[model samples]
Target: MRSHGGRVRAIITGEAHIHADKVAAITGCLVPFPNYPAHIPMQRVDYICVVDEIGDPAKIATGAAKPTTDQRKLLMAEYCTQVVANTPYFKDGLSYQTGVGGLTKPMGNLF
Candidate 1:
């Protein structure tokens, strides 16, 4: 944009990901703010403010945002839970890892 005579006074954003830094390197300043703008802070593009909850939930994860739920999957989760329960690893204070996927969704509820 600078090459095209475009001016970037500030960048009003939430999290400062890699893209934000790239812009900051060329822009005037970087101003990181919360997801809600009416709360506080205004200026940007020169400095970077890494904060939390700066993204709009409605806009975040445009695709594959919603979780999956179905009777077949639930039944499968129930079966899997039972199998896990029968395993020796299902003891107290047991720790397990799971991915944010459809199959794991129902399993989480069971646990």
Candidate 2:
């Protein structure tokens, strides 16, 4: 978690053994947030899968723009939901690492 001024940012990352579509489906199943803007800090998730003879390696990467206070809540909800729904594959494959803010928070209030 990172904080800037009076706002706090948190990123939750995990993996799933399912396809990208399925992950997106799970995200839709979770919460509905508005479109992500282009200038926000990015949070990505990757899913890797392998099925016996049929190897289906897949990944799901999602990002949201710097959110408003309410939007931050939505993002947290979505992140938590995604992590819980795909617990079995959490520690496998690639790890999900997200950075908040612009590398490091600026010295003063950025309003």
- lDDT (10s digit) by residue, model 2, range 1-111: 234422322222222222233221112222234334412222333332333433222322123333234655555556664654477855544344444332111111220
**True-vs-predicted CA distance for residue 59, candidate 2, Å:** 28
For model 2, give the 10-residue run with minimal summed lDDT: 102-111
Clashes, model 1: 9
Please report, in order, the local distance difference test score of every candidate based on alpha carbons.
Answer: 0.57, 0.35
Model 1 lDDT at residue 84: 92
RMSD of each: 14.6, 19.8
Candidate with best lDDT: 1
Model 1, C-alpha of 63: deviation from truth (Å):
5.3
lDDT tens per residue, model 1, 36-90? 4322233434544555546675674344543456778779889998999899889
